[model samples]
Target: MSKRKQNLVGYLFALPWFIGFSVFLAYPLVASIYFSFCDYSVLKKPVFIGLDNYRELFADEVFWITVKNTAIYAAISLPAGMVMALGLAMLLNAKVPGTTFFRTVFFLPSLVPMVSLAVLWLWILNGEHGVLNEVLRMVGIRGPNWLGDPAWSKPALVVLGVWGVGNAVLIYLAGLQDVPTSLVEAAELDGASPWQKTRHVTIPMISPVILFNLIMGIIGTLQVFTVPYVMFPGGSPARSTYFYAMYLFDNAFLYNKMGYASALAWVIFAIILVLTGIQFLLARKWVHYEAGR
Candidate 1:
């Protein structure tokens, strides 16, 4: 095929995604950037109001609270969940008798739709008549109201995060498959124990994959909305599970503070960007890519 024809064909194939993105996603993003600077109340036309929305961000007490809650949730969930996932992956990699069964069991939760899973968990973690609390009772320990209590609500969501650890485990499993067998034997010959082999060779080789999952996990956690939004009531039971995205949604749709919500959106995007950048920077010290010296 001629060069021009090939280029034209490539563009034709790419056109659908480009058009959908521009219409559905890109337009909203650009609109939000403009919306962030306006005095929009959702009932009236937006009026340009420079940095007013941003200034309010600092003074906004609830915004700061949401930020803190979100940060705490992410800090608690990300490392813990990844560690759990890595541990599970390592165990699964050992080629157990029921490896496939365990893999299926682990991955079943991620397969379930988010709404369905949330509703199921709601009942399971209910203050009374719940299986989890009943199990606690079996152990002679009184269980707290998980969703109804503010202190336990966020932690409950972290527990829910376990359901999706299967996906991370799958990624780690793929990385494990790529690990060199010769390297393991060589390390064993050098008197390295199984722990040492994994610590030095297996982990370093899979560090890039680990880093990929970490980045995705961080971004996913930051934008977490549905699980908490559904599991606990929206901004409910003293607003304990009111995630940052949930708060942003409430401002825009429920409260009619469109401009402020847009401002919140921009801040979220910026925060994610900064956090991702920091991860890449810090990964230089820890994430061992094949090309890195």
Candidate 2:
């Protein structure tokens, strides 16, 4: 084909994807920005309202509650999950029998559908006749109502978050395997204890991986929805389990406050962006790169 004709053919092939992107992703994003500044409901046209939505969001008590809940949940779950995942990965990386089987067992939970997992945990964490409580009772201890009490509800969800760190464990396992054997041998020759070798050599070598998981855990924990939503409907037990994303969803759909929801969505985007940027900034001091080193 001639050059111009070939170019035209290529454009034709790309046209479908370009159109889809403009109609779906690009347009919605732009529309959401505009809508955030207006009073909009899906059933009616958006009316420009200046900064009213944002002002209202700041004053909204429930919004603040959700923010506080989300922050606390992330603060507790993120580090705990990372530590547990790393520990499991290290254990799996050791020269132990049935390693493959154990790896599969750990990873299998992550493959379960989110709804199913939530429902399963719902049963497991029930206040009465639950497997966990049953075990506690076996040990002559009375278990607290995990989902029925506001104080324990958030912690219950944290447990679920930790349980599903299988994906993070796999990532850590890969990073662990990539550590230099020579460096470990040198540490051994220097008479470093197991903890010293791990702290001085293995962790530093996997610092980049740690940074990746930390950023991902921050994002995931901040946007937590499914399990809590399913297990604690309407953030019951006094809204202690209510999270930012769940509130956003309720505003958008249940309350039909599209404009307010859009504003909230933008705020969430900004929060994630700022936090991720902070992580990247701090990573410079700790995350090690072989090439940079």
Candidate 3:
């Protein structure tokens, strides 16, 4: 066959994927961007409105509420999850007895189906009869109504979200395994304390993995939906759990404000882009990539 024929054959093979991308991903993205600038409802033809949707979105009280809630969730959950995962990974990295069993125990929660996990957490955090509260009662400590009260609701969600950090733990563990033992041995021979060695050697070596996990955690927290939605469908006790994605979902479907939702989604996309870019910029100072690896 001629080179041109071979090239045509390759293009034929790639056509399906190209078509799928154009139809599903690229087209929808472009459409949403356009829709965000118009006045669109599913039942009505979209009319170009020139940033009216964006202006209205900024003025909407619920938009600001959802932003505050999402920001709070991201601020609290991301660091807590990352720190917990790193600590767990460090513990599991130690050559302790029954480490495999403990690792399994820690990771099992992440494998639970989302619905099942939500239900389980609902029960566990129930104020009146929860196992957690019951234990607190035994210790003569009063347990707050976690999901019921607006003040405590987001924290409850954060706790539930942190339970699934097992994946992060595994990633950190992989990074830990890749750290050079030669550096560790040198630190030990230099009579470096355990904390000193971990701070100077292990952490710096695993900085790239830490950066990866941090960025992912930030994005995940920003787009948190299922857990909060399932736990508090009505936004619960005055919209404290009404996160950005949930608000966007309600605007798109429930409220029949497709344009507004599209605008909200674009805003979210912008926020994620900005935050992720900031992380990458800051990572230049900390994330250590080894030579030739």
Per-model TM against the reference: 0.96, 0.95, 0.96
The pairs that clash in candidate 2 are none
- What is the per-residue lDDT of model 1 for residues 30-88, given as tens digits with 9 covering 90 to 100? 99999899999978999999999999987998998889889989999999889999998
Candidate 3 C-alpha lDDT tens digits along 110-211 = 899888899999999999999889999999999999989999999999899889998999999999999999999999999999999999999999999999
Candidate models: Cα lDDT each: 0.90, 0.95, 0.93
Off by over 4 Å in 1: none
**Which 10 residues in a row give candidate 2 its minimum summed lDDT?**
284-293
Error (Å) of candidate 1 at residue 84 is 0.7
Comparing 1 and 3 on lDDT, the stronger one: 3
The per-prediction CA RMSD against the true structure, in angstroms, equals 1.4, 1.9, 1.6
Q: What TM-score number comes out for model 3? A: 0.96
Q: Write the per-residue lDDT of candidate 2 for residues 76-99, one digit (tens) a residue.
A: 999999999999999999998999
- The list of candidate 2 runs beyond 4 A from truth reads 1-17
